[model samples]
Target: MKKLLSFCLGILFTSTLVAGEVGSDCTFKGKKLSGKVQFVTSFPDFKVQIVDSFPDLKVQKVNSFPSDCGKWQEVTSFPDFKVQIVTSFPDIKVKYVDSFPGVP
Candidate 1:
């Protein structure tokens, strides 16, 4: 009861935060992120291993959707594209990979 409520609240907060990110060009929108991710070039770039994940970043050579909602799963290797994770106030960062795909 309490735990479930708390979990739901936490998810709600995270979802809102992800959606409230200003100037965010990412098309994926979910309470959680799925697929394996990797930084392209020591930079904040990240790449996931799957495509069914929510909110596909809309980058070529990768299997991502656009502005959706769901959970994020982690993979082992050979991700789809590059991405950055901002665990602070914003939760995540998908900006740097917006216009520039295949960057790592």
Candidate 2:
């Protein structure tokens, strides 16, 4: 009985850890990380931090064709998603690259 309980607890812990991981698919917390993005000071859909290495997503800023994952187009009026640049406590960490933008 004790061994069974330990096994169940271990499974639960592993699942919990996996649930918080962000994949290369560019989706986090059910929010898709593509399309036109707006930078805002407040009331953002996601808060992100720019990093030099070990990023959750590799981002490429584009003028058009933000349809693919990790591609973002900056817009003011109509945005598919809004993000706030934060120094700390970001929802995800990203690295801006010139090419090959996607989950890494």
Candidate 3:
């Protein structure tokens, strides 16, 4: 019985240690634009996607990084929106892009 209990505790601790965390300070502030931007996890890397939004919704990406995330961007704009960060941070890095380029 004791052995089983110890095993369960070990598993619980290990699982908690492997949990993922996302970092982003996005307030998703906008009138016609109301969307939040943040990271999901930094396991392998980040991902990107571009889809149509509501009317006049300006999805402007600022290319941001969490203060605790330890990401840096001397210059913005990456290759595939999934920019790989070069920092030793526990959290992931992120940046902003005008996902919503406003109306024409």
Please name the candidate that would achieve the greatest TM-score relative to the true structure: 2
Model 3 ranges with Cα > 4 A deviation = 20-104
What is the TM-score (0 to 1) of candidate 2? 0.77
Candidate 1 TM-score versus the reference: 0.25
Q: Which candidate, 1 or 2, would have the higher TM-score against the true structure?
A: 2
Tens-digit per-residue lDDT, 1-104, candidate 2 = 99999999999876644313456567987878899999999999878889898788889999998998999999997898898998876778889999998888
In model 3, the clashing pairs are: 59-99, 59-100, 60-98, 61-96, 61-97, 61-98, 62-96, 63-95, 63-96, 64-95
Best by lDDT: 2
Shift in Å, residue 13, candidate 2:
17
* lDDT score, candidate 1, position 99: 42
Candidate 1 residue-wise lDDT at 19? 26
Q: What is the C-alpha lDDT profile of model 1 across 1-104, one tens digit per residue?
A: 99999999999887865523312333233322334455443453433333323333333323454222222223346743345544443323333233444212
Q: Please, what are the lDDT tens digits per residue for candidate 3 over residues 46-100?
A: 4323323222122344445412222222332332222233333222223333342
- The CA lDDT of each predicted structure is 0.39, 0.85, 0.32
Error of 1 at 43 (Å): 2.6
Q: Number of clashing residue pairs in every model? A: 16, 0, 10
